[model samples]
Target: MNNAKRRIDLVLLPIVLLAAILNGYGIWNDQYANSYYTTAVGSMLRNFHNFFYASLDSAGSVTVDKPPVVFWIQTAFAYVFGLHGWSVILPQVLAGIGSVLLIYFMVKPTFGLAAARISALAMATVPVVAAVSRTNNIDSMLVFTLLLGSWFLFKGTKQGSPWRILVAFALIGLAFNMKMLQAYMILPAFYIFYMLAFQAKWRKKIILLIGSTAVLAVVSLSWAVTVDSIPESQRPYIGSSETNSVLELAFGYNGLSRLTGQQNRAAGAGMPNAADDRNNRDNASASVQGSGQTGNSAPSGNPSDDVGMGEMGRGMNGMNFPQGGQMPNGGEMPNGRDFGGGNGGGMGGMFGTGEKGLLRLFQTELSGQASWLLPTVLLGCIALFAGLRRRNITMKHKEAAFWLIWLLPVGAFFSVAGFFHQYYLIMLAPPIAALTGAGFVAMWKAYRERNGWQAWLLPLSVMFTTIFGWYIMQVYNDTIGAGWSISELIAGFLMTIILIVMLNSSHPWKQGMVIAGFMVMLIGPVYWAFTPITYGGNSMIPAAGPTGSNGMFGGMGMGGRQGNGNVGMTPPNASGDADQSFPSSSSDESDVDNSGTGTPPASGGNMFGGGGMGAAGGRGGAGSRNEEVDTTTLNYLREHNTGETYLFATTDYNQAAPYIIDENEAVITLGGFSGSDPVYTTEELEELVQSGQVKYFMVGGMGGRGGNSDISNWIVEHGTEIPTSEWTTGTDSGAGFGGQSTLYEVKL
Candidate 1:
């Protein structure tokens, strides 16, 4: 190889290695990463039918709320590697590394080695990207598939081959199957870029775009067509859908609901949105009330009621409290109109919140994690346009246009989009990194030539980034104490001085200043990413950064304070009473991040506060025990399965996932996730009981999932509630299922 090529290879190798280390370092630490999906993977490994539907149980009773593409890849690895946590998560890690390498090659062909190296490193260190890649979540796969499509498109645009363009759109179709509509966000850029860059006549260009669009549609819907074609009886129920249809699940729950915020509450028996879910959880109790049952009903009140505030220090299950001040004289909340709040949280509200409009993406909860470099990236895109003005559009210009289009639309969408997890921002990382790389080089060239606009641009970008970095760290400081923010500020100040000195110094120092600026800005996010790996963070609502990580604090409180490790998700201290930081049960959704799975509530501006990390600790620790199965309850399930296809059935997948994962048995969920999707009618359930397909029904309550009132009501009326003490320990262990899972044997 030539000198320049060899040097490029050397830089590329280390960046790739860095990405692998970031993703692979604590692989074994989080054994059952995101137990909700991990359980589904375990079930999919059982047989072909379950595999095809992405079923959450061996009996093929119900499917996960997501598409099957991610599970398909995870299952293939489990098939070859024998189904360990490492095996399940291996695909994402490999995909992440491959993404970095692909980006390097894609940029190297156009922007050269310097831009390629910058882009690769920028993406490699992004906190949320590392967080998702290290777990079984499919966002990494979606990102990889999209990047892969970009690679093919890059080749097609260069070669002027229609077939290559067809392949490019086809890969995007594959990406669609991975993440539903999210994969389509970049298509406009892909189309416009191809049109501008393709060496073809106008008529030919339109024909090519039309052909690719057709290929895109055909490939995107192929899996949906086949799955929908299967008879409902033979396939698993589509979780989270109002109707038992994958297409509806995709178009409604996963598609339109995300944009319009018009939730099809036709399924979830009208549980209030995520915010009200938190209020209901706090003011009420986990115990459900029925004839001759010991559960408590909710008090008639709004979210502002302090009825149950004093019980916050009790335990993670947020139940078993003495009810008086918070309820009526009989230890029950006064009956009234249905709970307030709307249908949000869960899968339907993927991109919504009470907040909206342009600045929404910059909220503290979002900025600290994914948006650490967002401002600079946006400025870089603008700088690219300004620098290239009045010039004929070359292949490079078209490439720049593509990256900007890919970035701005998605950025604007998230800014104003209603509800979404912070990790969803991973989709924007690549384009941001690419634009920053190209913009930096262009600005640097102009600066070397003493061009006034370019000279000011580079320093101004660095200066603005330093100020933003300091602000983000300050937010981190307030949310998670221990003076971390001050440290970041000091470091940033030192870097700013170095940048100023280098900019004014001789030739050798100018390049060094650029490297310093990137490093200084990267310091905070890189540390945040490391926090999850070190302190351990894998939740249904996955986040990254110090706020996302379980930190130096022993236990977290709902107000985002350090607790005595009693009432929070962490085990109580030696004393039963907790450190008096706050009070409320674990059931309160506000205390938890809830992003990793189920229906995450509308996450507003907790952006920099590490507020979610407090709840992340309640998820139990990393390692083999991470799955948090109640051994006593699991053994009861195994012994009494009695030749039934399902070992037990619960209200929703979150309630059933631990048992399915721990026992590797078919633990069916009656209503699917959010307890909104009707997996089985009461009549159908009775038929299953008669056929011996199900026996023990694990009931009582599940957060957000109590939406399936009919099934819950049916089980209460027909099934015999086994006394809590009979089958397992009555005390809440602060682990899986919170309190003892209230079990009931269906009477034949």
Candidate 2:
């Protein structure tokens, strides 16, 4: 019997892992997330592994927003493939898939095969899980590294492998570098409780504690030195301390300042998160601790006073509060992020006037900020249930409680930090999934004890059926649209019926239920892979990209609206309006100290910022360089001497498009977008053309910003016909436009 079980485990492990991988495949078909470009891709380009590839800043300082451990994978790819989109993001997708597999491995002993399989399947199809798994971002890396570290510790304790403890601690170090200290949340607490519960011997205890600490210090501190060695100027700060530079910006203040209001930057259009975080920290600390971070101010007479009772003080007791003036009627927010002025304090106006000078507290607080506590309450219930059946639960749980305990901290950490993004809590979903799967088995047995199987089976399965329907309609709607064919519809219904017939019964029934669920969802997801994707559940890929740099990812059916009321994608190059200016700056490090002797590279300015090539910018004179390049592209542009320039359009509507990688194959879909997708902005086109930099412009579906104002007014006004012979902007050498786009060129 034991040999047969071992054989079965070996066979099923590969099958399950392969399926998890397939779940992430085709996720990069469109731009779906933001970090793909800024943090993830930037890391790939700047670091060629060997610690620090080259600093991005021209002054040559260490860039330290994120730890280098995660970037190591991204840079390794960049070293060979040259910082293309696909290569940078692929690692994230694999890591996400790997995390799912790890969850299954961790929970299998406690939950039994049927429950473990169901949990993995649920995780694979859960909408947020599926969406995040496909992007090039650190959140997935954070989760994977955390789980890897947990599995090592849990398995090591059970298997008596001390080496595994060192490895787990090392992973925690890597996770710290990937996403700050959030990686270490479970350690001290988990260790203390585990030791007390398991009754550790002194030698074993010292080895686990001391050796793990040493491993952590070595792995984590190395990145600290490499990052801290950087100078101050290259760092980004509306106003954060240097001891608190981008390093603090990325990890500490970067994450916590937003919630605590250290940076006064508010959430909204025109307001970067920096201001709310930078300023609010002082304000919030003042409000909560009385005087300031120095711990001055007097204690409040009432523990539930205004600021104390209101949104700002919600986290003092591990609560989440609404930001700004919330709806009086207790309405839910559209997005988890609060886009208002008064910071994370709920109903900003209600508490008092929007006073930067004083911290005013309100009596009533809403529920969002405190959302992290939901899992704790859930764990409490689970613990109570397990305690009732302590004998049954103990032997059935190989390491189930360990995983449950580990999963609980992510929420506690978020709650204490007071930073709340609904989906950021998606990190908690895997464990919840594991718990629920295991819980169902335990619940089913209890239910059967009361009602002899048949009575409970139909209702329980129906409940799952209802949950899946909700997921399809709301969560997975991007893939499985409102439209369901007869075959899919019938299969879905039949599967539900089969589950109803089998639920709450023993293993045979559970096996049948799973097989039916797998067949139904597994096939439905494959269909979602090829269809036109949506953004926030609206529109196809934009003709124009999103607002600002590295804004929204993925294709929306209609072009995305910009924050400045530019309706539909990135504004085109053709703009007479100075209100809409290019992101150009004298400060772009790419331009400083660069001296190219020959014809300048496609980039408009010299490689480094200071001094110009030739007469002003490069070694070659301005007029002698090739004049046939495109000016419409983002990220890079090649300059020509004849007053004409070309844009390869590297940053498509959203830079989700691919660069001209040789052989035209994507390394990874950064946000799952090819970046080659056709997109344009009339504002960008007109502005460059009028300035004489844009002799020709590439026009496609991307030019919908400000609601056709550029094309209807500016492009139509400034553009005129010229013969092909004189049209050196290459209007005739037309590039094929794809995905609801039209290409056009202008003559100067």
Candidate 3:
């Protein structure tokens, strides 16, 4: 028996390590929606505090929406890898791995081996969980801390030990330190629900509950207390004042404003009426409407409703600029201009003033945000009552009561949010994973009675279906968010129906349903992730027009500089405009600058020019000039025979330097000659390829800011833009005349 148990342990340990290893691996470029710098910056800032009690305030402030736990994690990486990319995120990868192991162990004791394994695998690959791992945020780590808290709480109750209580409280505190109160609320809420529903011994439950709550209060409050005790200058940017302000914003202005045309989060974008109504009335607003607590509607003759065009005139829709509001002449407003108040003149009130009364009301209504889990949170509260009242609590029910209480506190915290993202769903999964795993284990006799041998079909079907479900969900999410093709949507829909049918049919149909479901869900994601089908076969490259107008920089940023684009998913440009595709970003010069050539400086990193975004990186002011491309670009020429990278050739800071330096990745300017200037001859451009120095001659097309049509004539004369004679040419490409841009690659 001992040897058999040892052999089983050997197999299990490897599985746990493998899952954790994959969980901790590096995130790709797109998972962050192409924004790794935010976490990198946050890590650097908090890492500063990890060393000393110092105040930091200067040179353009940056703060994330959450707390310092994530920063601390990255700070650890900073200690190991220095403050930069990939390394700082390595710890999270480990936490992710740890989470998988924790899930397996937490469930294993309750659910038995099979269910625990499936639970581990299930949490590891779920779309949202996958996203959290790939992101540079706190969700994954929070999931870890929550898992730890839940496990130890279960242990304490089961073993009649206070050490486990300390561990649980410590985990709660760590989670609180990580992302503020969300973890605190989310976990405890779930624990309470489990306790009340099952544990009948009220008095002992009460004692354990109070003991755990007291323990949690002490554990979680230590950091806040320590930070609070510090002098102002010492821990300047490191506490929870903004947390309340943001909650006010979320529940007050951002929340209340959404009811009418007031707090539109996407205020300026001018979503189509249909989409806007659907978004506003469909998901968020619908709940408010159902509750019958929605506020007053905007009056027809309200002056703010009569708002004009320009900055102030920017209607409730935000896309609307004020008519006579700002610049009377209709041009740029002064620097740091405030669109304060509303459409008329008073502050547009995005986040209204934080009156205590209003915040209370907001918090009250906002309590319903996590309504789904509140009742459960309450039950765990009762279970705590039973534990505390006990004299001799040696039963399994008493132990389950402990886990129920611990988890409830954390779960209820996030449930209070007005909105929930996939990351928010993180807290729920671990407990559910454990519950599902363990519940299935405890109810084996029952499930066998309820499902019998057919019960075996349950997991097999869910596994196969979940794999399928993941694909369909990806296509649906990617397409909707990224706007993929009509044909792609049709294919996705068809596959979804097949999977739905397979899952819903009777017993005999289960096998066929599972198989067919798997095939359909597998289709789009696999093809998109792996194939050259190009953004779901819609030609990531735009179709050519009859006017023979090739687009800017061949076919690069037009695909997307963020989100889906970074993931090789090209954005849609239905308006015939190159700019309005995927993830609406401010054409902020910084975005254009960073997206173009110059490398982003390392933390606290000032640029060295050629397009550096350091303190003097040509970001602001009237006409500053400190841009420089990478020094590597000067010598980083690559072999083109294998043809891997794309290039944009330019010089003259005032001309193409900012845009091309990072965007096209300048290697060498082709002909028209000068250092970093257009210099290579067609033959020289070709020779650079032979020398493994250049692959593209990145020249000018119309709308290109500087330079000439010579590069254009050059491209047409020597290269091909896209494939297919009919659709490839800029002219006679059918009815879509003057509708597209052309990009020519020199075959040389």
Candidate 4:
């Protein structure tokens, strides 16, 4: 047993190291990566108030959409590591590596050493796993937590310790705090698995189940309950919920709305009409029917609503522009730009909106990332059932049943569910990896033990995986290009030949063939995973594949340089009207500073040059310039400050985060993300200004959410814009496209 254990450890060592390296490599390059969460991390570190509320600003005005569990973990690390990007991201990297190990241990007892090793390797090489682990995304921590729960539950069943089962359920509850309803996705699987596999008597088992569930419910709601119990006036506004309730957030925006496709009233892109009728009614006066934006709605009568339209004549009459409700005379209101448009490819495929039900998971966008070995795992599950059918359900068969159950419900939910993201696929990885490892071991054993149809199972699994891989290459051909297809085909053919050799060859050659075949099966995703690292992968949307031009992975590379164009997921001409793709240069050259502000310098052109919705390299118009707060602006705010809590105010966290990171000052965001969440009313902000709590207001470009109309209108009507000449410095005036930051002074 000792010798066997050592050999298993040796076999697993390399894959573990590879996974660790992939997850940690070059993780620090994108400083303040994904300003959305990074901003929150910086703010949460400010005080206990920000920490508890998970506020976007140190002032504790508004909170991030999700709960604070992941942030708590990140904050602990940031405390020690000094708030650098790596400080927050490193915890996720370690969590990812630990998850891989847990999956190995979780499967080894039932599947044997061979299956355990394979499962770990499969997870280690999965692209989405690599992507999420490397970024500051909370999903990695969430995935790791679930895997840990699985480990404890497996141990509890084998040992008959209700304590272990309690711990397992408790951890799942903690995971709920990490991502709300998403953490409970695996609960049904846990319940069924425990009931079938535990050694307890029927009555005891029922009691254990009920008690553990109670523990889960309590642990899950602990944070939500605490936050909600506080008086509304005392705590930060609960973000992204219809009512200002965390429970509603759990059930609505983060729960049913996710499944039902109801856009979050306070988060996401444009405020779609699909939102609850209450949101529409609440913002009725300000709400315009459509400007084609998604996350937050820009209000009617704001000149910003008609930004960049050559034909201002479209709806000028309806707009109540801040300047006495008069429309800014037409021919495009300088630098007005559109974002997040275009028909993304894979729209009609299996996992796309076009493909409605179970077949969706089989599509290219998903299949290539998490399902490389899906067919193999499914076959393995079937074989496990067949081999043990004659025997009464015992520990062995029950264990296999547990994995199958785990795979089925979650797989079915994501398959037919309305919403899907590449990162969400990480939740499915463990089960898929487990079955692949154990199932492959089972097939290999059946093949060795007999000269029956089971022998064909191993080869059949490889062939199926290869065929699916080929189809994935074809589907993503636009992003990855035809060149990748040829390589994948060549690899597939080579894998086929190796399988044949293994079937006919003697012992020594057979072992080698097995290694070669596994490598061939994994080569594509492995190669894809490394490509993201080589390019400083941006975490805009964590995914695995060739880098797209300013896409999730590709944009993570050095300063927004176009990706290799190898990734074909993006459709050619999918982005509508190239002319409108980016904001054109302004004739007013005064707003730009030629001085070296760092890299491209602080100017209009650099700001709008190459960013948009989901633009690669983290340079989205408003989001692109967050890492570097303009020193000039920072200095001016510092020079003209009152003894107040916040340094200044912006519509959202985009502009505020830079100051928080660079100046160590709290910047109030009037609206939450996209300026959508109603954190404070106009009167409330006016009171803040009156009391000298927040004295400076910054408004340039679109006010996030529906903030621009109200705040912009109020500031213009009640406050004054400090001209670029007075407050700013450099060869250019301080203004440019959507990315430029303009300052204003509001009088109490």
Candidate 5:
């Protein structure tokens, strides 16, 4: 037994190494993965106050959108590693790899060694899982926390221990803190598994489940309750909430809005209505220029810089295209003019979810991410229950049912949910992997024994999965080349046929054929998984595919550059007509100059540049320049500092994030992320200026959302605008405000 255990462990080493390479390779090249969260991690490391609230800036003005648990872990890592992109991303990387091992151990106890090995490989190679693990998004860590909970849940069921069950529920609660209601997607699976697998009386089972429920509620709501109970004056306003309430943020924006489309509302209370504000801004812009530029327009000469804010706002608010919003050069934004509350159509459609229907998962937009193995998983589900009698419920049957329960509802949710990114599909990976591993063994054994319908499931599953993979490949033929898909289809069908022919032969021949068939089935996903490392992936909205046209991967190609050519604003044509074709550069390097200063200002291209929505080592959009502050500007601000609490204040976090990351100083983000959160009133702003807490105010950029415009208007009326020549050097204005902005010195 000991020797066998050693050999099994040896076999697992290569799988672990593969996961590490897929998740950790080339991560150091990432300067700052998702600067929004990266900035928060940097701020949290400053002191205990920011650390506890998960503050987005060192000043602790407002908290991040999510709860603090994951950020706390990231902050600890930044503390040890000195807060680089790699430092914060390190936690998720480790979590992703750890999930692979957990899948192996969880399966090994009941499903045997071969099943565990296959399950681990599946978890490691799913494209979306690898894409998310490479970034600092909370999904990878959330998945890990849930998987750990599953391990405990499985152990409790095996031993019938209520204590282990309670521990499992507690972990789920912790996962809720990680991502709120997303963690609860697995609750039904846990509940059903415990009721079916535990060998207690019905009354005892009900009592135990009730106890677990209480524990889950306690753990899940503990942080939210504590944060909500604190006085509004003492704590920072909840970032994305409509009423400055954490509970509302969780249940509304991050919860129901995930299912139903996000409603148009300001981020906090005492804010102007979103629709009215949007209309007023549209009328203002149209009256000023009559150029059809509405709320989406940035300052002249820097058209594409603010396009990311539109993308960010749409992504957060359900892909609502601004009315009459024209891209630079008169190009119309994609996805039609339907604002909010509608289903995205097929491939390259809105939200990357494809059409909302039963076939949604099979569509080109989503299939390649994690659904490549669904055909096999579905067939495996049938094979697992074949020839089973209701009276004889074995551990294998119970485990299979647990994974199926896990897969179906989550799959259904994604199929219908109004708002979600492609990376959220990582939730489907574990169950698909588990069922694939267990089903393969069960069907193989049935085929050898000639167990009727079970005998053909193995071959049928391989053929279907192979064909499905070919369809996904064909969708990306322009980027990955069609010849590769053709080869896979031929090789996969041939292997399946050969495996069927060898059924009457010896065990070794049959096993070889089966292994060959599975290998062919894995070819596409493995290649898709490698695309992130090869071409680079979007750290902000992580998706896997080749970069070129806006197909399923939405042109996320060539070192993580957005493929749709939404680079910095599009430039005008020779005839002065707006060029509709947002042309993208073929190169794999950032077009913006670093300006000889080691610290690049996080401006131009995407809001976070290559680190945010901009392309990695490529042009973010056409005519985009580096938005980093020039040395002259940095020196001016430092020299003119008058002991203010903040270095300077900007309308939005985008204008402020780069400085926070580069300088590690207090820079106030007045409008929060998306520049839409109403964090202050004009009177409060006047008070801040009067007390000398804030002296330098940047008016314009992506700030002044909703009710916050009063603050900007007040500053312009009373303050003095600093001359650009005094602070700017060269062509760069040192501000990527997504629009024209003026610096104002506000004094009594």
Candidate 6:
């Protein structure tokens, strides 16, 4: 037994290492994985007040949109490691690795060693899972938490221990604090598993289920109740809630908005109307086209035309065509729309989730992320139940049903839900991994026994899944090259043929053929998983693919160029230092050092105080950079300080993130993230200024989400405007506030 356990441990070691390497390698290069959350981490480190609230700034002005559990864990890691980019990312990486191991342990006792190993491998290789785990986003941690709950739930059901079942629900409630309602998506599976597997009278089982639910409610609402009980004056305002209430924020923005496509309304009371958004988008499009360069620029007049296809396009072309393959008619190929941009059909498509339908998961925008193994999962479900009879239900059959229940509701949600990011696909990983692993073993046993139609199910499953993988590759052939699809097609067919031949004879390598068939199915997702490390991924969006410099889905759709926006157009200085250029409105390029250090050239006068429109600014917004507050600006703010509570005030979190991260000082964010939240009104700003809690106000940047226009106007009317030369280096590019930024000194 000890020797067998040692062998199992040796195999598990490599799988864990694979997950760790995929999630942690070169993470420091990102500097700030997602500045929004990174800023919150920095603020949380300042004091217990901000820490408890998950505040976005040190002043405890407003909490972040989600609950505090994940950030609380990240905060602990940051505190110990001094808050570097990798420090915060380390927790998620470890969580990701832990999840992989959990899958092995969960499946081994019931499904055997081979199934457990396969499940672990499937979880580790999922592209979306790895992509999200590499960043500071809460989804990876949320996934790990949910999986932990599943572990306890599974154990409790097997042992028929009511105490363990109670503990399982409590852990799930803790996961609710990690991501709100998203954690509850798996509850149906938990309830069904316990009801089917636990040994008790029907009435007694129902009563225990009710008691467990009561425990869930208590653990889930503990933090929200504590937070909402605090008076408005004592604690930070709920960041994304309409009524400054935690429960409202949870049920509204984080709950109903996820399914109803009403995110704009639930996000906050104030948002830019359609006309303003259209005008801004139009102006941003014109700026991109007028200047021949593209780097983090916003979408153009047609949102579909804004696909950024620079490096990935070239890479694909090099792979497919011996001589450089150019799009016919000067970089114009078929219009495949933006890979994951634009509202393809509905509100969900706006955030790159693709249109709502049965086929939504299979669409190119999402398929490469987590759906590659879905075909196997569906066929494997059939294989698992092929020989089971209703009168002879077993624990294994009950467990199979548990995974199916977990998968269907969650998969159905993503299929039809109106709002979610691509990385949210991680929710589908666990069940798919488990079903694929367990089903493979079941199918293999039937094949060896030659159990009628079940014998053919194994080969059919492999062949169909391989074909589906080939189709996914073909869909992206224009961007990622047809070479991969063609290679996989040949290999998959050869393996299928060999497996079929081996089934007819008492072949010694039949198990080897089965493993090869699984490998053939995995080729596409493995490549997709590796792309993030090969080409940098979007830390903000956390999608797996080649995103180019614009950091959206690049080269995954059709077309090369010839749009209002420079979708596939490479910048003239593509090979030069990225910090030297800014997306300007004029055709002539500025020689400004965009690192916010050097003075602007005399020919290119400072736009710091000018009315000229520059690029859209924010961490993941078009034309933005992950830059810190320049030394000159930091020095100026420090010198002018009058012991105010806040060092300065800005229109939104985008404008304030850099300063908070650089100095860990309080910088008031009038609006929440995206500048859309009605965090404060002009009257509140007046009160803050009068109380001497805030003295400096920076306004008129592209980052203003229009909710705080009144505050900007009030500052310009009453405060003294400091000249651009006072604080800014002439070449100062707004860290997140695009265009020109003006500093105003508001007096008492």
Top candidate on TM-score is 5
The CA lDDT at 367 in model 3 is 19
lDDT per prediction? 0.58, 0.36, 0.34, 0.60, 0.66, 0.65
Q: Candidate 4 residues 1-748, lDDT tens each?
A: 8888865588788988999898987666555555556677889988998998888777888877788988888888988888876777799899989989998888887777878899999889877788778777778899899988988998999899999999999999999998888898888779888987788789999999999999999999999999899998999877555577899878865677545443323232334432332254235333311221112223211111111111112212222222222222222211121111111221112112224466657765466567777878877776777656555676667777777777788888766554344567788888888888888777776655554777777777777777776776665566557776666667767766666556744666676666666666675668666655653354544556653322321212222222343221211322222211221110000000011011321222231221322221133223234335667777788888867667888764556766776567888877665455567777888999888788887654334334244555565556666766556554233322233345668887
Worst 10 residues of 3 by lDDT: 542-551
Q: Global lDDT for candidate 3?
A: 0.34
lDDT per residue, candidate 1, 455-514, as tens digits?
A: 656666666766776676675554557466565566666765665555555767667767
Top candidate when judged by lDDT against the true structure: 5
lDDT of 1 at 594: 20
What's each prediction's clash count?
25, 106, 98, 38, 15, 3
TM-score of 5: 0.87
Q: What would the TM-scores of all predictions be?
A: 0.81, 0.54, 0.47, 0.82, 0.87, 0.84
Tens-place lDDT per residue, model 3, 485-555, is 34344544554455344443456654454334333333332232221112210011111111100011111
| Number of the candidate with higher lDDT, 5 or 6 | 5
- Evaluate residue 152 in candidate 4 and report its C-alpha lDDT on the 0 to 100 scale: 93
RMSD of 1: 7.8
lDDT (10s digit) by residue, model 2, range 1-748: 9888865656446545644554345333322222212223442453243135222221112232345565677667656755443455567667767776787776677667766675665455444344344444455668878878877876766666778778888888887776565566667544653454333687877767788889886786665555456543333211122243435534544455424533322111112233333243334323322211111111110101111112222211211111222222232212232323234343222121122222111111111111212222243234325544545645345355554666656645444333322224446656655664565555444444544443343334434433333333343333334454334455666765665555444655665564554445444333332121222211111111111111111110111111221111112232222111111101100010011111222222221111111111111111112111222332122332244433322211222122222112111110011111112245544555666654432222112111122232233344442233342333322121111112234555
Higher-lDDT candidate among 1 and 6? 6
- Cα displacement (angstroms), candidate 4, residue 285, comes to 14
Whole-model lDDT for model 4 versus the true structure? Answer: 0.60
Residue 638, candidate 4: C-alpha displacement in angstroms: 0.6
